[model samples]
Target: MSALDTDRYHIFGVCTPKDYCLFVDYVIDEIKNHESSLLQRIQETPDPALRVWRESTALQGTDIFEIECVKDRETAQEAVEFWRAYFHSLGETIIEAGHLCDRLD
Candidate 1:
C-alpha cells in the first residue's frame, strides 16, 4: 500500500481509570460543543479515528486510549496535536504519542 494509505498516525498511552474517565469526558464535551474539528470528523465518519479499551494486568487494569486516522499526514498531525494540547491543558502527561507506523506492516 502507498504511504498515503497507511494508518500510521496515533496517540496512545495507558492511564488510570480516573484519568481515563476525565479524558473521555473532556472529549465527549468537545463533541457535544462542536469545538473540535478532529473530533467532529471522527464522530461523523463511518470509521472512527479514536479507540479506547482496558487491559488487565498484574496490577490494577489500565485504560488505554488511541486516536488514529488513515488519512493524510497533515490531518493526522492535527489530530495528534489536538490531543496533545488537550492532555496538556488537563495536566495529563502522555506516556507515548506519535505516528505508530512501525507497530504495523
Candidate 2:
C-alpha cells in the first residue's frame, strides 16, 4: 500500500501516459508563463488544512496528482474541484479522478 493509505489526506486527480511528454512540456511552459498567477492563487488560499502534491512515474509515464486536505471529505472535495478547474483552465485533460483512502491492512 502507498503512504496515502496511511495518511490523513484525501487525494484525487487525472493521469495519462499517452501524451506524457507533450503534457510535461506544456506544464513547464505554462509554469514559465503563469508562475505568478499560480503562486498568487496558492498565496490567496493559504489554507493550512490543504496540501497539493504531484508525482511522475517514469516507468508508467504517468503523472499522478492529488490535493490533500487535512480536513473533512467536504473540504477535500472542494479542493479537488478547485484543482480540477485550474487544470482545465490550463487546457489539461483529466483522464480520471478519485480519492485515496486508508487501507484495510
Candidate 3:
C-alpha cells in the first residue's frame, strides 16, 4: 500500500449548483486520475521546495478547469501543459494553485 493514508486526501472544491452528488462525482474522478501521478511526482521529488498545489476553478456556468501548480525550482516553470491537459479534459477551470507538502508535524 502507499505510505500515504486516506487522511491525506486532496482537499479541493467543485461547485456544481451546490449539488452534493455532482461535486462528489467530480472529486472522485479527479482523485482517481490525478492522485497517482501527483503522488508519484511528489514522491520522486524530495525536498518540499519541489511541491506544487494543483487547483481548478470553473466559472459559475461555464466549464473550465484552471489548474496552477507551483513550478519546480529546478525545472524552472510550472508544468502547465501537463496539468492543463488533465484538468481541461475534465472541463474544469484551473483557478488558484500553489505548492505544498504534507507535514505531520
Candidate 4:
C-alpha cells in the first residue's frame, strides 16, 4: 500500500429527502469525475500541510448515505466541514448531519 493508504475511516452521515438521491449522486459523480473532489484537494495540498482523509471519497447508500473517507481524526473533521459546506452551497438542506472516526462498536 502507498504511504497515504490507511484503515482509518472518516465517516459522515448526511441526510436529505429520499427524492434527492439523484441530485446527490449527480454531485458526487461530478466530484469524482472533476478536479474539485476531496481527494484531489488533499493531493494538491503542499507538504507540511498535506493531509488525506480517504483514498477514495463517495456518497454511498440511499437518502441517508454516509460519506466514508480515510486517515486521521483531525482530517476527518476537516473533510466533514468541507463536504458540509459544499452541499449547503448547492442549496441542499442538510436537515441532519453527523460524523464519526473509525469504528467504536
| Least well predicted 10-residue stretch by lDDT in candidate 1 | 52-61
Tens digit of per-residue lDDT, candidate 2, span 3-55: 44434433433344644321111111123334344334333433432222132
Ranking by TM-score: 4, 2, 1, 3
Candidate 1 clashing pairs, residues 3+ apart or interchain: none
**Of 3 and 4, which scores higher on TM-score?**
4
lDDT (Cα, tens digit) per residue for candidate 4, span 1-105: 863454454444434343331121111222223323433433443432122222222433332344665466566667666665677788765423222213322
Q: Which ten residues in a row have the lowest lDDT in candidate 4?
A: 21-30
Sort the predicted structures by lDDT, highest score first.
Answer: 4, 1, 2, 3
Residue pairs clashing, model 4: 53-70, 54-70
TM-score per model over all chains:
0.38, 0.39, 0.22, 0.41
lDDT of 3 by residue, 12-99 (tens): 3333343211121112123334554434533354443322221222223222232332322322122434443455568754433334
Candidate 2: where is the Cα deviation over 4 Å? 1-7, 20-62, 96-105
Worst 10 residues of 2 by lDDT: 21-30
lDDT of each prediction vs. the true structure?
0.39, 0.37, 0.33, 0.40
Tell me the spans in candidate 4 whose CA falls farther than 4 Å from its real position.
1-6, 18-61, 96-104
Using TM-score as the measure, the top candidate is 4
Better of 2 and 4 by TM-score: 4
Q: What is the lDDT of candidate 3?
A: 0.33
